[model samples]
Target: MISGVASESSSQLLPWQQPIWQDLVRRQQQSGLPHALMFTGIAGIGKHELSLRVAHWLLCQNSSGQADGLTESCGHCHSCQLWQAGSHPDFMVCQPEDNSRQIRIDSIRKVNEFLAQTPQISRCQVVVIRPVEVMNTNAANALLKTLEEPAGESFLLLEAERFGSVLPTIRSRCQRIQLLAPSAEQAQQWLQASGVSPDQASQALRYNPQAPLQAQLWLEHNLGEQQQQWLDLFGQWTQGRAPLDKVVAAYTKMELDDVIHWYAGVLADALKLTLSVAEDQLLHGGWLAQLLNACGDGATLNKTKLITLQRNVQEIQGGLLSGAAHHNKQLLNESLLLQWRALLQ
Candidate 1:
């Protein structure tokens, strides 16, 4: 659905899909093409999908190898069909396994072997590596030799979250194609086109369309429901009679890492209340006056909220919360809730 051939059932292509596809089509249409291309960008930005689309285009038998005689393997031909099914003997896609972020040398060796042999079908052998920077030393070494020549017609599509972390030798041999997220407006539009409500689409843009699903789920599930629970607890805490320990325990059970985020949501409501008698509606404008009153009636809450955001970003950058998610991912679930309470206080 991205830049390459789109079928009737293909998923809706995001805003960032067209540029890379068009570039490749143009170059291949013109002359001898880049065999090894490094598609570099942020994680979850659809780089993997982009790589597959290019592979499909390259191996499509229906394609008459472009206008250039230099182009090979027609897109609609038999070789292309095999590539589509991922049954093509010469094509390979490599990546790190679950629980490990680094690509082992063994994986690289396998890729090398796949490329070393002559292409059984198409003239070119396509090897795609996702998150190329995940290659460990031995893996890098194993791939380095193959990358140098990569055989004419051998196309390597390597995707990495960031470019700087990859080996210079590995990068030097390949052409780099940078992929970026579409504009915020574009992301919202894409989601709307996909049938999501405008409100949900707008909410998902908070993080990045690269991860719109994450933003959508967070807002719809966690923030929408759990956030209300938190607001109730916040109210009880402000009442003076509620034991701070019990309230703290409830907060400890809540899932929130960015304490500043939670605070700001409430803090904004407090400000809105003061400026215009918007009435009690803090935290979705519910009990706004109560929240403003709870904050002790001042602009100080805004300043505190901003400071909290700054501090949270710093600590997160330092991996201060790394231990929170260590051991089991669910293990961190508890730790995250506990830490959120402590951090906010």
Candidate 2:
């Protein structure tokens, strides 16, 4: 497990964060802090950021100074200084080890040990764990004991992008806060302010509506161009202009998982269009229509075929993520590509 002390930062809350932050601050002011607080939201929506801010707020020496407006950690105070220096004794964060993504039982045990000790500086001890769903069953079970009977003035802050995937038993013990995405207009404006073009912002938002940071990074990496190139190659292959072997060779040189995901997005859009789903539901939207006009004919857009393709793509993606190397890379790409080609035909 990776352990660290919480630190004070100059980062301000995003627009989507205001509601939840306000509520937490209100609770703190009322002296109604939850011993275990769960912050659940989509990835890249700043759940961890909000959690850290809350930690700093609770640990700040001058927390009472800002009751009228936005509360902040008095960065000049002793407590804030300790936090800034990463030597704060009252705060701790637990995470998965770099080599092993799983948060094992030993890590949770360490947390249990930390909580057992009296607060070193601040009156309350704080612990933060991110993406807590990565914790194995044993680790989670160990954590449940601490949650059931938290000792002293200790607080546990947990963040999960996929909250539903976390154990229900764990969920029941904590006070949950769900963060929703900002409106489309807000997301687009934020992206534009960050120097993304209108079209690029729209494309990225379509890919992941609740994750503006991910969308911005997607545009930064020029994945929109990559998507276009992949679609073009697929179109050519469908028309017998580009050979399957050539496309497979191209894919082998690029990130395999990303390619699969992009294809999955396109297929998903096509399926939605085939079912006459609302236009807003599509990731590609008008771009999908244009692509279909130039390439796809909806001949292979049946629900069963689309679902099967999605499932297969997810399975392959999972395998790749889990370090699947038993099969030859080129051969695997060729097989997947041929399957896609057949579906298109």
Candidate 3:
């Protein structure tokens, strides 16, 4: 069994988590903890973080229990120390394998073995399975057995961005908590606290909306800069100033999904401009001025062609991210970019 809690820094519950925290505490007090729980929310909203927080609290020996209604672990406790050291025997985390990106039968078998044993440190064993939907059919079936009749004081914490994709059998076995994005005001505050400037935070929020963590990553990684690079390259390719081979090579080197996301933003801005929509409503509003200055107004844009390209982008992104065993990704990406280049003409 792979044993450890999520990193200590990200395991603390956020301000937006108060409602769910209080609800879980009340549930624990009223009827004890559920054997299995499904933490469902949009991607990058800290669902995994919340799961880690719960696991830490449950396994912490010096924790403020249901009586005190705390949402965090006592960091000084031996259990917490063991967790921080990444050797807590009672805590097992299962995730998709590195290459396949799917939880396989082998991992689930280890979970079964782990669940059969008694807790080594705390009174309970905590198991975290992230993106539970990534479990293959066999792996999901294997897990269903444990969820159906959980043995000992074991708790299953399953995090999923898409609850519907999880096996219905597994979903039925666990108590589900549907987490929502924090309000705009709360998200903005969190962004500012993370050192994002007011203007940039607003732009990120506009770009990503409901997902503060994703927006933060976008800023931290300077994805905007990367997007600009792609935009400029595409423009050059369209104007016959850059070689298509090099452009394709550069695109295939970066993450395809992020490139697709950036393409979607660019296409959306073009669409909005074509329809004479307000600039403030554009997702790439921060880059709108430069985009228009370089790419010209959307007046001459072929809406049908843009829509077709957008659909192709989605198709390519979905194909690449499906975690298949093998694919001709380079050729596929090159062809897609060629199509996009043609559309620019």
Best by TM-score: 3
Highest lDDT against the true fold, candidate: 3
Ranking by lDDT: 3, 2, 1
Give the backbone clash total of model 3.
Answer: 0
Error of 3 at 116 (Å): 1.3
TM-score of 1: 0.66
User: Candidate 3's residue-wise lDDT over 313-344, tens digit each?
Assistant: 76665544444334454786677667655654
Tens digits of per-residue lDDT, candidate 2, 69-111, equal 3376767778778888878888888887755656788888989
Query: Model 2 clash pairs?
Result: none
TM-score-better candidate, 1 vs 2: 2
Model 1 error, position 96 (Å): 1.2
Per-model tally of clashing residue pairs: 20, 0, 0
Better of 1 and 2 by lDDT: 2
TM-score of each: 0.66, 0.81, 0.89
Our tally of clashes for model 1 stands at 20
How much is the lDDT of residue 143 in candidate 2? 97
